[model samples]
Target chain A: MDPSQVDVPPLKDLTIDNITDNVKLINSGCPDPRLKYLLERLVQHMHDFARETRLSHNEWMTAIQFLTSVGQICTDVRQEFILLSDILGLSLLVDSIDHPKPASSTEGTVLGPFHTHDAPPEPNGTQIAHDPAGEPCLVLCTVKDTEGKPIEGVKIDIWETDSSGKYDVQYEGREAPDQRAVMTSDAEGIFWFKAIVPVPYPIPNDGPVGKLLTLLKRHCYRPSHMHFMMEKEGFDHLITALYLRGDPYETSDAVFGVKESLLIDLGKVSAGQAKTYGVKEGGKLMSYDFVLVSEKESRELREKNAMYAMKDLGLRMKLYNGLPIPEVD
Target chain B: MDPSQVDVPPLKDLTIDNITDNVKLINSGCPDPRLKYLLERLVQHMHDFARETRLSHNEWMTAIQFLTSVGQICTDVRQEFILLSDILGLSLLVDSIDHPKPASSTEGTVLGPFHTHDAPPEPNGTQIAHDPAGEPCLVLCTVKDTEGKPIEGVKIDIWETDSSGKYDVQYEGREAPDQRAVMTSDAEGIFWFKAIVPVPYPIPNDGPVGKLLTLLKRHCYRPSHMHFMMEKEGFDHLITALYLRGDPYETSDAVFGVKESLLIDLGKVSAGQAKTYGVKEGGKLMSYDFVLVSEKESRELREKNAMYAMKDLGLRMKLYNGLPIPEVD
Candidate 1:
């Protein structure tokens, strides 16, 4: 008989809470220690959810669509799926659990949603932004080892949005890349940049990831922050982001990028003296030293730039299928 | 900034085998039990696979596409997706893991990729197919209770392919539903039918499922067999396929549906005796009976069917969005 032509059966009443035996069996078959443990745990939680909400097929399909969109919207520049991970708190948990940096070392936070590989190379203390589009501020920083001894001649790359919370490359209207620059730490492990105070801004949510947040009743704004990646001969290339302290949205940073140490106070300074530091007095200026643990090992120095990206296929039909599965970088 | 316009950073090296810790950490904050464990296991397997084969991103994408196709091609009638599950041994493993039938009782097998609900009612001893198609044989079957008592007046639905191992419905030029029929068990729990000895046949390999089998270098054929479903008031309904002993493809059953008890011997019989049994009785005939267990009090029985069905969206999506989650049957 044509199985396909048969009438559909009535729906069943399945849920997670009642499947302990089944879960046990599945676990028994999982030979991989990690996978076996995970399956056991995953199935347990799944069953618990089914039991808890009594979820329906329509709900399940809706989630499928949500995930599909997350994948579909992924591109080399953006990762909605990773954003989803961030919003769900999975990314934070992962970062925290994997990193056990000793005290005094710069704490690690999320790599935010955007991180460009290169910044225009600048010498020590060179200003990054070509123009001020936000509150003008002067930033100073120093690098040191865990022992608090200064480490000199280190490369530091810094990038951030203007007072408008916009990156230089973000503005197509910009005649040139405005706010990103590179610098080197001086003999005392000190370097400074002149730029506008960054402001809290909304993340790009016009796509499916935003739609999902709307559905989940979550906000799509990230706290204002600056990105930094420092590298010295034998030290772990530090990748981290610092958030503006007291930013109203800091508590609910969309990417959950804020950390206790990364949040810095942007104290106000007198206008004339601020001018000496390259900013209008009475505007916010901040100063802090980045104490990086010396490249402790070669492993950290060889770190891969942890950025999330997916392919886009809207090119011509000839390129639609993609480069015959091009080699993954 | 146009996120895509930034010079893309290199991706971190990740493998399926070494992802155990990654899964654990990523899901460390997941309050839901299943999602945490599932992600942990999935990551582990993914990393393990990567470590073992050094799989590239393109290959990973290929896997993602293959999984997507499995979901896309699935429908109520043609569950190629489920077949994919069976081929991967996931279905059987899941079924067995989730539903551990007593070793002494019928070992629940993969509910092959096809199953329909509405079957036209038929009476005891009524032949579903008139002409014998494959090997000529008489099917003898009786339903019994856990105590070995007879289950009289049970409804036994029957269907099988022809001597050439061709299912009537599988043929394009067919005018009728061949090699199929339904009959009820008599008061003595006995039922018999005459049909041609069936031949082994290959499963449909035109779809992505076939492509996977080819990629995995597996044979895609199954030994000829009869399908049956028996139900009565006192015991749980049994839905199972019975394989013909000595069928050429028995060892290589495509979906691995073979069971020791389900195999029926195909033996020669005298012509007059065949006439007595209402069969032509010259050639080989495959025959077998079915056994079913009684329904027990549990939450899983009510929802087992739904849980297995909802897994088409991948384990993660199923946990998040798919609902009406079935209990382990």
Candidate 2:
């Protein structure tokens, strides 16, 4: 063995090249061809971007901390990160890319922060509101086919906030789901739920996401509205929500989930129409209908079960062994 | 407020498209465009990578932990992460892209981990070995123009290990810069350092880098070689090391810092050449002459400092909110 080769010093680490390497590892092997390409290109671009911005470890850790807080704030009723996604226009961008509308049917908007499948179905024109003090209202919805023909017997699942701006899931269980009800349309593809108009309110922020907003100089509130889950034969399942006529976050919902057609006006009805719905004289009420296109699924359909926390645990174990998983549970 | 316009959640503070908006409070800008681009890209990719990989909170924290350990392992004498860079071939890629050499000049290898810029200069044909146990050798060199014509007054700053396989910096200040020395040549650009043949040795592996290597299933040793810094007016500054032929790491040096021209063979020398260098009749040494071309200033010179660490500190601070710093100083 020639003795002269041993004593030289090693070079410096943390060069731009190595940083790029670690990022590539994150893109190891995604199943989705398009997602894989997007992620690979994104990883390359991000590494180049980080190197270009000269982002420091100190700053990166803060971002991690903020994301953690965003996760922490999420619960059965709230998803602040989704709100963040909407406002950033990422969700809208993805949604539009995945589901481009032709502008004829009811515009699809974000499925606002609260939605649950299989809500208890109520009879047509029945009051879904548990709060007697909420503004007396009606939600008349028409489930239409592509040709604008009303599709009778279509199931339109509905959930929303009460007059106090709180969801039923937020309260105790065993009573029926408050502000949450399901309705099936009649022969005209028209379905109406007797209820109260939702109140506008801000999303809960008392976490790192809030801290992030302070750093970015922005606000955190979502306009109030009812959510809709509808399914029809030969059409994709629609998970969407409609917005009220007037609220502050109309243009800048934190989740950027709004679409132009989803906005609807609840016009005042004549006393003659109100009497048919058992409304007292001078009682305030509203009605509107929604149109849903087939909702295409983007990601591989992972079995979504009630044991979400367990699924999250399982996913973590998988990745610890260097396996990859989607961020959702 | 038009309630119809209000279905979206309010925009929040978690995202920003520009780095300057956050860094502006500090009044500093990144100098290198590529570095800037890299840092920005890194941040974007890492976040997306984390999101895509569903990099969990604990996992993200674990990464931060791993990085800190990597940092803690770095010292004045050893840099395992840098060694990692070398082994991964990142350093070579950088060196190759930045320093393209012509076919005529001595090729550049890694500036191994133990370089101290100021070596004492020696006269032409001077003996550089402090121990007589080294191989008795002669390095006859001829410096010339790119066309092979000789040039004068060339200086060759050289340093290398001794027969014991240790560097001056490897051990404490007990030995006076063992087998390494600086030397200048005649008007022709030819000079050599006479040192005992050094043995190959393993780099420091008792730290974080060592731990990482253990995890990565990699070795921590490098081949033996002498460090060389060839600088002249009009020639590109070549900071490189020469690898002795036949060392084990000559093929798999933990740093992968080897080049073809860097490989040199040591043979027995004549009594007449030994007498000229003041070596005894049968001393141990070898001979090597470096041929260099007119060094071109690196093209990156037109660019600013492109290192990501400097470019990204603010982002680090912003993300981590004051990450713990290593007590290296």
Candidate 3:
């Protein structure tokens, strides 16, 4: 619908209090109802924010320039906007809303900006860390349904920061993946991998987001954790991370990704204990059980929140289809 | 302050209801009170927007990508974010709040992204448009205070879209400015100039902002208008534009920059009438008086709204100093 063709009661002398109403009126011509709803909500919130804060002209320009810089710094590998969202806790909120889980199922967290699709497939119990200097650790996990029936062949992509507190992708001129691997559960619905004990690390702070954190007087570190992205047929996909207990930054994970249930202790394992896990040397043991939600149940929960989920399905298709997937050599 | 050093009551198992509170809590360490207030207000609005609309992860990512593109497309001359702000009516809202005026004073509007300081200065009553093919238009204006006493030496920067509905900067490989100039009030506190009648035109629509307008099913044309930026030492700086009466886009300006008081009729004039204004041929006549608020009175109003104005003073100094002024050769 052309704006001139749309009927509007002549909008004149638009005052501060009236402009938002006029904006909503002008946007009433939007063709998509979901887009309309989303835009209306957005307008309400943003306008209210400006009015409540009594945002000055100069301050608004400062924000404009800041957001512009945040955008300009993005590349195929770096996503400053996502980092901004993470630090603001928006990323976690979105995850909680879009992927609600019952207490019986393991909770989910942010899939921090470091996940890569090129992680090499490794056999069960294989050492994922290539660096011999990193403190050795063993992860033991089983995948099962809410009813406790073991579900085999679950695809898992696990990655973590090295002891030096950085992912492989964080290094320049990176060739192959380290401290990360892709594997599947065995017949007994059990999967295990040997890797370095992950360490707490700061997010990329060389960008505007980093500057904002400094301005906020907030630290940039996430608690030490290992990331997991899991999927299996007839089950809901899960993206989560396990925070190590007693990490200094645990209570203040910069991205607000920590969940109480997701915290686990890395027990000190003696050589005899390591031998049971088929390792020759002493190492840390990280053990936990993973729970899955059936696809049908997940769909039912989404239907319960059908207002959002209905639009979400279409958005998912369009987003992934239209989005540019960065080229990885 | 370091994350480990801040005293935070162990935040665990953060749900949607509590995450916002926790975010504000974590950010409470921000040393600047004004910034803290702004961030708190911003977080409240944004979080409420998400929760109220049930924003999905896919939708959030779409916004992230869109904003990134808007930022990526900006250049030395193009400010896509400002255009975005204009179309959303945010620019106008900010102007209204920051530059509130007495009914007698000329109201300010958005400084639409076409302004350039390099506009060559012209003598009063001289022609601004270089193109001979354009329909000549004579502008007559006086700068006066609330008492109707003429004020001399008010510097005015005037610019408008050409007869082809584009700014001089819009043209590819443009060397010098046309349809724009800088001038000052004459001895009688009056200034007159000859220029082409500006035509309604679309803002830069090849960017994300344009796509958003199309998605909203709205036309992109602003009403034909001439922009004016005036500054006099003892008066409040005024940035405004005069909208022509009866323009097709008048009722639905793409940027919402129109006010009833700012609209004027461009009366047809004979060659005889044009000669009186110093134009040699028959053209259109635009006659109006611009009223300016004294600096003292403006400051009083701001002081009345001191909650914002106090911060604005510091922001003005920092914004101009820190902002990169786009260079024009």
Query: What is every candidate's C-alpha DockQ against the true complex, given to 2 decimals?
Result: 0.04, 0.05, 0.38
Relative to the true structure, candidate 1 reaches a TM of 0.49
Highest TM-score among the candidates is held by which one? Answer: 3
What does fnat come to for each candidate?
A: 0.01, 0.07, 0.61
- What is candidate 2's lDDT per residue for B151-195, written digit by digit as tens? 676666676666666666767654455566667667665565456
Per-residue lDDT over B1-329 for candidate 1, one digit per residue giving the tens place of the 0 to 100 score: 22223221221221222224533443344445444444444445434333222222334335445545555555434556566655544444444433434434455555665444544556543455655333356665676665666677777766666656555555566555555666777776677766555567767687787875554345577777767767677565565677766765665565656666667676676787577666566655544444556666212443443355445433323232332421321
Off-target runs (Cα >4 Å) in candidate 3 are A1-9, A120-122, A125-127, A175-178, A268-278, A302-329, B1-9, B125-127, B131-133, B174-177, B268-278, B302-329
Using TM-score as the measure, name the better of candidate 1 and candidate 2. Answer: 1
Q: In model 2, what lDDT does residue B215 have?
A: 43
TM-score of each: 0.49, 0.47, 0.88
Over B1-329, each residue of candidate 3 has an lDDT whose tens digit, in order, gives 46656566566688877999999887777877668778887888788777665677789989999999999998766889989988888888877776778888999998988888788888888888877667788888999998999999999999988778888888889888888889999877798898888788889898899999989988888889999999999998898999998998888888899899999998777677655776656568887899999978876675455444434433321221222111220
Candidate 1 lDDT at A100 equals 32
Task: List CA RMSD, all candidates.
Answer: 14.0, 15.7, 7.4
Q: Could you give me the TM-score of model 2 versus the true structure?
A: 0.47
Give the worst 10-residue stretch by lDDT in candidate 3 chain B. B320-329
Of the candidates shown, which would achieve the greatest DockQ relative to the real structure?
Answer: 3
Could you tell me how far off, in angstroms, the CA of residue A102 lies in candidate 1 after the best superposition?
2.3
